[model samples]
Target: MSIITNIEDLRQRSKKILPRMLFDYVDGGSYDEQTLRRNETDFDALQLRQRVMVDTSGKRLGRSVLGQSYALPVGIAPTGMAGLYYPEGEVVALAAAEKWNIPYTLSTLSICSLEQLRGSTDYPFWFQLYIMKDRAFTESLIERAAAAHCSALVLTVDLPISGQRHRDIKNGLSVPLRFTGGGLFDMMLRHGWWRRQMFAKSKSFGNLAGMASAENSKLMGLAQWCASQYDPSLSWDDVAWIRKLWKGKLIAKGVLNAEDARHAIDHGCDAVIVSNHGGRQLDGARSTISSLRSVATAVNRQAPVLLDGGIRSGQDIIRALALGADLCMVGRPYLYALSAAGPAGLDTLFTILKNELEVCMALMGIRDLSEVDETCLENPRYFSREY
Candidate 1:
């Protein structure tokens, strides 16, 4: 634990530090979790073609997406209730992303608000949104993001209905956090986390609770209100509506098919993120990396194609790029690190991934991310079009 070697090490540490319900929330996916397993396991099927003789001395990890250059071909994907993992978690993660020069996406349900993050650092971050039942509330959220000077708006088009995560039900990690005696014991065991939470700015959904409380509902009532407001009526029409309202880089963050990717681009999305909601939505759906191949082919460079899920290492990022992803977004990796060691863990996580990427690039004789392609893999057709 002292000398963490990789993301898995961070994962192990996080599992110990985080309470059972919290850890399962971050770790488990929907239904049987078949897609969840595939997200990580699918990477093993693709092998990187290592070349030794060429000069890799001028290597750079930098990759440009939608006119902005990233420190690496990675960004932190939006995760709800991120602050539950650590004290002021979203703020810490955003600051870390700023330091690393990669974008940190603020979730609609994040514990820290956009203003908090903007105040913490002036750097522009991405905001992920889910169209709510209340159009006014959703618009207000959009207005807030614009006020915060968010660089991009990631519209997550999946989850019209919440997936049944068995672990959460079993653990009683409900909307208002109903806890059984055992669940209370489990949470209480992580004393440091809750102790720090007492001093933290907001313990509930930062972006959401304030939205309602300022109007009529109190905290718990607001949580209930927000919970019931996830729009099952969210549709393609809503996409166009949001597109007209906001004039920033719009990224569709939950696309899993070529047609969906094309539709997002056609609907004014600046880019399409090939994701399966980290297998948190549909259980039997294809892994994001597995689907990236065909989606990238369909996109054909019209706009950036980003991959989310199944990326555990720098090598996985390489695989994603070679398959056609412009960049990658990580959720669980950073979450694990943050839960394990707070702010320093974020630095360590980025450091480990950067070094791993650098070493992988060096071994592959790749000068930069632009030099990466399908040819870098031994058998490039590991990703299927069958989906």
Candidate 2:
């Protein structure tokens, strides 16, 4: 195999190794995918000022978020079905984050249970919770996180209803994958991936299946189970309620509008992520980068504003920082790494990004991430006027 040089290469490799259904699940976006394409393109439009003859030595990537130190400002966004990417990919991903001294957030919908990761690593990683119609189940999950010693609770408010990804529907992407005769043939074609995944251990949605006997439960598939549980009527009052329950740093994910940012702060949220659910929900929603400036301004620095969507590289992370995000979360890139190369692959991807980020910062004449701001961006002549 050729050496993996960058994230793009890893993505290509992942595509080759993973089955079509699973690869599309990780890489594809909602219907039309316009927002998905824009997420990456918008970052390219921004230009960084290059400084020559600047002192090159002694730069640090270390930073803090929510009163905790991170090796860098990047965190892994929670992705469901990570195990399908690789056998026990969540464990490998979190373990990688622990080694790097950054936070790894476990998705509420992840296949791994809180118990599975509780003693898996020494670091107390953060936990993400999606408010469900089952209030008892949601509360119990929060209790589980607390019991597992999670340091923060990230409440994802965007996906009240799952977005319609046409690819997923066409590919029959569901939990406990229904392999029709054709599907079995497809699985047989990707024998290497199937062998590693199937032989390592039994696969189940560890977190959900733990709550009840999945075999006897009414929810037959992942889509059905997720649809029945997500609380569509969630309100700010619920945020306040969760605030009292968590007693730790609270981050509200999926905020793209300024009004929501202000309300998140009012409800005592410590941070508001400027995200469009990675373009997975609301296909036509404004790019998280486009909406970020207003969202950041509305919050008025009262709360840390982070972003996640369309970030594919270290340069993208820098672009978000320049635009006023306190930090950035990467979803699909790491998933690709985990799927393509396992723990070793993730390590390679992180190494390439860290090197590239440092070089970009040095060339831009910035000593640290704190030095990045609006000065590096050009306001388009057509967009200078207020909307």
Candidate 3:
């Protein structure tokens, strides 16, 4: 608990607790991992403006996204193997989101089924759908989400083909973890991990296991399923069809280009998240933060704009908001927090972020999140001189 000071601290603990394969699977990126590094560093390039003599007491972080008010504009992005991190990782994350009064998006690949989540949690959470070749199955998933009373449908459009992650391939990362001799030996060294798994018997993928009974008793690897099922030919027409099936808010994720952003708007997407699947897809793709302003301006701010990828601190959140991202999502940071110290760690993360944001707002001389707008950022003079 004491070691959990920042996201990096959680990462270190998770690295020690989880097996090498699992840690690499979550932390590593595709190919060169250039985009991954950029996702973090690009946010650093954006500088914030500080003003003096403005009151910042009692500043509120509450926000509304797609007609729903949130205690914080931040939401947990969908991660596939959350269950692997700690038993029922999705449950832990959703529970945390519920406690924080923010939206929690369940991944299409989640181990915990929508019903399981809905039954356990009171409020409706958002659902992220990955279009598959089987239109019937995809439609069925959307229908199930609807049945679960999901408030929003997030359709990920970029991963037509899975990115080549060297670490996953080398480590043989799968859902029902294939325990090799090395893996078992590693697990043995991690006495704490073994104790938790053996005693709690929480290694099961709660949501997905029952849905597919044949693989229920056995471990099901997410990468293998994704490789087999992710539809490569998915297009805008699919989005239109899914939108019709889902009556609630529809958001398009993996949007990087302005043209695609416009297309998302054309299909009536309530919002579009400018993400490269957290650098899990398109290895050298532009950072979501770098692409935010153009995409937001391209859509003419007509729809709510959300950004994800490389958001580690409150300053990064502020930078995104100042650059036109109405809301943002963080993936690994929350996942790390969950893996390191479970619910308490996550609570610590939320408190730390809230405090960091308050300090930033106060230092920037703003009393409200709404007031911390694009004007608070000083666009590079060299870049602006061309204008």
RMSD of each: 1.9, 2.0, 2.7
Best by lDDT: 1
What ranking emerges by lDDT with the best candidate at the front? 1, 2, 3
TM-score of 3: 0.94
Q: List the residue pairs that clash in candidate 2.
A: none
TM-score for candidate 2: 0.95
Q: How many angstroms is residue 66 displaced in model 2 relative to the true structure, after the best TM-score fit?
A: 0.7
Expressed as tens digits, the lDDT of each residue in 68-117 for candidate 3 is 89888788998887877777778889999989988889988776778878
Please, what are the lDDT tens digits per residue for candidate 2 over residues 344-364?
888887887788889988887
How many residue pairs clash per model?
Answer: 0, 0, 5
Give candidate 1 misplaced runs (Cα > 4 Å): 175-178, 210-223
Per-candidate local distance difference test: 0.88, 0.82, 0.82
**Per-residue lDDT of model 1, residues 241-348, tens digit only:** 999999999999899888888889888999999999999999998888889988998888999999999899999999999999999999999899999898889989
Q: How should the candidates be ordered by TM-score, best one leading?
A: 1, 2, 3
Residue pairs with backbone atoms closer than 3 Å in model 3 (clashes)? 111-207, 112-207, 113-207, 175-221, 176-219
